[model samples]
Target: MAEKKQWHETLHDQFGQYFAVDNVLYHENTDHQDLIIFENAAFGRVMALDGVVQTTERDEFIYHEMMTHVPLLAHGHAKHVLIIGGGDGAMLREVTRHKNVESITMVEIDAGVVSFCRQYLPNHNAGSYDDPRFKLVIDDGVNFVNQTSQTFDVIISDCTDPIGPGESLFTSAFYEGCKRCLNPGGIFVAQNGVCFLQQEEAIDSHRKLSHYF
Candidate 1:
């Protein structure tokens, strides 16, 4: 008999939490960082970047719902939306649900993540990519926010943990650029990790966002 393979590691900013991977569906290192899709007995299908758990099949709707609706609904009106990161398209799927939205633009730092997720993580996208009102931009999200003159009624930063290329997405400069990219009375939302899990992420993002917006 052969022993089953088990994967264990310290992931993200969790001091003692660990991920024991049961099965690997895809693993690759893009120019940005290590990307992986694996299945765990408890978590079901999961996506992680640089060893940090990102999205899981079972509980994705909770995160996607909160990240999408609170801002869009609070703003009272949102016709155009911009999504940063979330190459998996989970956020995109939620944003497009609103009939009031006229158009959507998503800027992802790495196209590989998008392509990988689109194939291996098809449930997240939910055919939102085919929507005529949606446009995909594969580029550095920070650069897109800084350069694009277009404005949106709602902006969502569904980014990874603050590390590697995602580091720049949480800076004050990035928030300022995002503010500039928004139309009047616009709502901006970011997926800052839970304070208990990744305290710095939530605190740093709040500090920067407060300074800029």
Candidate 2:
């Protein structure tokens, strides 16, 4: 009879040496996409939804930095910020870069994502989860903006791609709500889908945004 393989041996065979470089979470799937969650020494914990790498815990800073800083610097000063759909708190970390920022409201539809990040994605949050300057609301982004009368100096939509649960975020109604939620001089920005693969949608979205703003 063949001897049983050791746990490490089995893992190495399953994921290969590259996959074992640094792992935070790991699970295999026979019916659906193979889920592999790992921490890159530089990028942090990353979730692979369907064998495709999702958000990483570490390098998220690069995206958040570029997304938040360019606008803030161009605007010269920003005191209030609103983030939509950044459940991982990465954007919030970047938005707080301005010391003058008095308040940051984060609207995330799924609190589970946030909770998971708090537990396993420390590199992204950096313990900002409990910061008094930050207010987290687990609610629909559209509804939150619709009900909110307070305006913001900058509104950043850090949502996922326009599929799955984030479809409403890219709708005309959503943009209307965003316009209403922004201060007179407020700037609104969102990370649209890939420019190469989603050119038409991108163009349409820009046209819609132009109409609203």
Candidate 3:
């Protein structure tokens, strides 16, 4: 029998999680970060970036649904939606479910992340990448939000933790740019890392976002 393989999460030095890898699906250093996809019994398939677990096939729906639905439903008649840093396409899948949302613009920093997820983790996207309302723009989220002439009814920032390429997304300037791109009464949502593990990040983000919203 082949020896079992395990994948360890490098999210924190003191506490983390690990998974038994049933199969190594894809692993590579993308243009922006280290990416990996693997199969596991408990989570089905998992995708990680820079040693942090991103999405798993089993429970991705929970995160994506909450991120996409609550704000969109509350806004009631949102037509144009903007998504920043959701290269995995799970956010796209959930947002596309709202028939009222006419347009979805996804700005992802790494094209490689999109490509790999599309190929290796098809379940996460569920063909939403080809949705008629979906548009993919490969660019830094900060630059796109700051420069885009267009505005949106809802903006979802499905970024990673405050590290590496994602560090800039948590800054006050990014929140200000997002504010600039919002139509009247627009709603913006972001993935603030687990509050217990990243209490400082959560606090800092709230402090920055409070200035604009």
Winner on TM-score between 1 and 3 is: 3
Full ranking by TM-score:
3, 1, 2
Which predicted model would earn the best lDDT? 3
Best by TM-score: 3
Candidate 2 segments exceeding 4 Å error: 1-36, 40-44, 48-53
lDDT (tens digit, per residue) of candidate 2 on 1-213:
554321121222235223334545655552322445565565556755434344675566678888889877777778888999876677887877688888999998876667666666677777776778899988888998999977898999987666655778998888999999898788898988677667877998898888898
Model 3 agreement with the true structure over 7-30: per-residue lDDT tens digits: 999989998899999999999998
| Model 3 residue 121 distance off true place after TM-score fit, in angstroms | 0.9
Clashing pairs in 1: none
Candidates, ranked, lDDT: 3, 1, 2
* Candidate 1 residue-wise lDDT, 1-213, digit = tens: 565566544454335455567789999999888989988888788888876778889899999999999999998889999999989989999988998999999999899899999998889999999999999998888889999989999999998867778888888878988999999999888877678877777887788788778
Q: What is the lDDT of residue 201 in candidate 1?
A: 74
Off by over 4 Å in 1: 1-3, 12-14
Residue pairs in candidate 2 whose N, alpha carbon or C atoms collide under 3 angstroms: 43-58, 44-58
Q: Report every candidate's CA lDDT.
A: 0.86, 0.73, 0.94
Cα lDDT for residue 121, model 2? 68
